[model samples]
Target: MADPSSQNPTLTTPPPPSSSLSPTPQSGTSELSPPPCSALSFLKTANRPKLRVTSEFDSDSLLFLNKVSCKLFDNLAKLKLSFQNNSQREVSQPQVSFTSKHVSVLYDIEEKNTFIKSNLDVHPRLQLRAIHNVKAQQGEVAMEANLTEPGYSLELSSPVPIGYPRATLKFPLGEISLQEKEDEEEEKQKRVLSVNGILKRQAMNGICTALYTDEELRLRYAYKDDALSFIPSISLPSNAASFAFKRRFSPSDKLSYWYNFDSNMWSAVYKRTYGKDYKFKAGYDSDVRLGWASLWVGDEAGKVKTTPMKMKVQFMLQVPQDDIKSSVLMFRVKKRWDI
Candidate 1:
């Protein structure tokens, strides 16, 4: 006979343990723990909106505060307070403005003026603007259209109730390529031509304007390259002409010149930028017989509105050749805060 254990294997082996009674490590134990309080608080603060304040101060020739302005704004609206000091009187003005995705409204307390602007969804390039003076009971409305495909624009404006309307049209003619010969040392250049037409009805009788006749017309030519730019414009009827050019010697140095043939005046300016925050400009004007110099700190490339810096300062000086004793010095300071 076999042994009793071999004959009855079920009795010798112990029964398997149930899964509910077995001991095992928990797989989600780490994930069940809560995050730190500091991390949650940081995330909440970052998503909240904050108010912004901007202050600007300007001093003119008399070394007095010519203008002082303070602005407070948030995501929806803006409020501005300004104080102006002149020779005759002092004035304090308050302004408020509200802005949305497609519409904006502005009001001036001192002047009793209201301005409204809206973008029309019916046309991608159409815009409407209106202004009203409550004290004078006068208003104006303007409509503008931008044709991007043809590089053309049309604007029409008229006074409220009864007034002559003014219209302007601007279109680009074409562009020319000026290529250099293989042996030529000069670089290739491109020139663009554009034209502008203005039609206006006379204020006296409102009958002077004709569809075929433009009250004023102008032709503009522009040539720009990596290091140089030249722009010239000539006006019809009056035959007035003006020219402007800029030359860049380096990434941070440039020289600019402008001349008006009708006025027989000219100006030349040399600008040098150091790093990202400092700029210096020196210039002379033939019309005013003045030589001027200016220095800027904080804002680079003259981008005052978009700079992240908190403070910006500008200092300017003008010396007259005819009367050195009547020289003028001016300065401006701007500061911004987020709270």
Candidate 2:
């Protein structure tokens, strides 16, 4: 017998190739990474702040205050809440936004600072804002306008349909000046009155002052894709104008240039980063009137374990200014803890 069963063999087929359209699932935390952008993009973002609590400890302030023996409110605790509706497709109900923050000196438990704000969409094109800044008092009803002071402020804005411009009207009620010295002193604690109306469009934005000034204009452009940008703006009734350019050559290298046309002055800056935790910037400004150079270094680190905490510190130096002819040294630090 020549093993007839073994001679007759079975044929097995291989599996089909995996499609490139779908990502393969992995066992661990293997999520897709985020998209890439320029090194300076983060500085330009008008990011809507999120809800969080921050506990800060400023070592420089601590040292300076200790040196001067005027330590009052250095260490701080801050709580901020911000919420908004980011949906675009659904437009049935009114869109809304809320933001509030409370800040207090850790050492002084009684004194506190608070800011409450709200934005509501009256319609698809109309929006309203209300903001207040007054600490809560026991058994006292907080009114829309602070009874002791006019701390209430409002803003109304109407944005045109997509592809159009936006307009805003600001009513700084808290900014009103008083006639009497007592009234002025009372209103001094509140926000100063500087009402304005603004019209904004892509690449161009303008502002018209209500209580003062004629107008302000801004123009922006990108000189290179993901690499360079230039912004120029001028203010009227003051004859002030500025033009600036920014460049991000790589993840670790950046540069910027700024010019004050009215002053006939210009400045240039360069920045570099190392790994993920360190960054340094150096720059110089020179003109027919004045010139100086400066440098800054900052670092941040975090640990996400029990009693979560974060710390940030920065050191800065500037050369020659304001009668005295010597380099000035400055230091700042901040630390945060979860509540």
Give the residue spans of candidate 1 off by over 4 A.
1-49, 61-91, 122-135, 140-158, 164-214, 300-309
Model 2: residues >4 Å from true position, as ranges? 1-197, 200-224, 236-239, 286-309, 321-325
TM-score of model 2 vs. true structure:
0.41
- Provide the lowest-lDDT 10-residue window in model 2: 64-73
lDDT of candidate 2 over 295-326, digit per residue (tens): 32234434312222344556766664454465
lDDT of 1 at 84: 45
The estimated TM-scores of all candidates read: 0.60, 0.41
List of clashing residue pairs for candidate 1: none
What is the Å distance of residue 74 in model 2 from its true position? 30
**Residues 204-239, model 1: lDDT tens digits:** 322222122224656556667789888777877788
Give the alpha-carbon lDDT of every model.
0.65, 0.42
RMSD of each: 20.7, 22.2
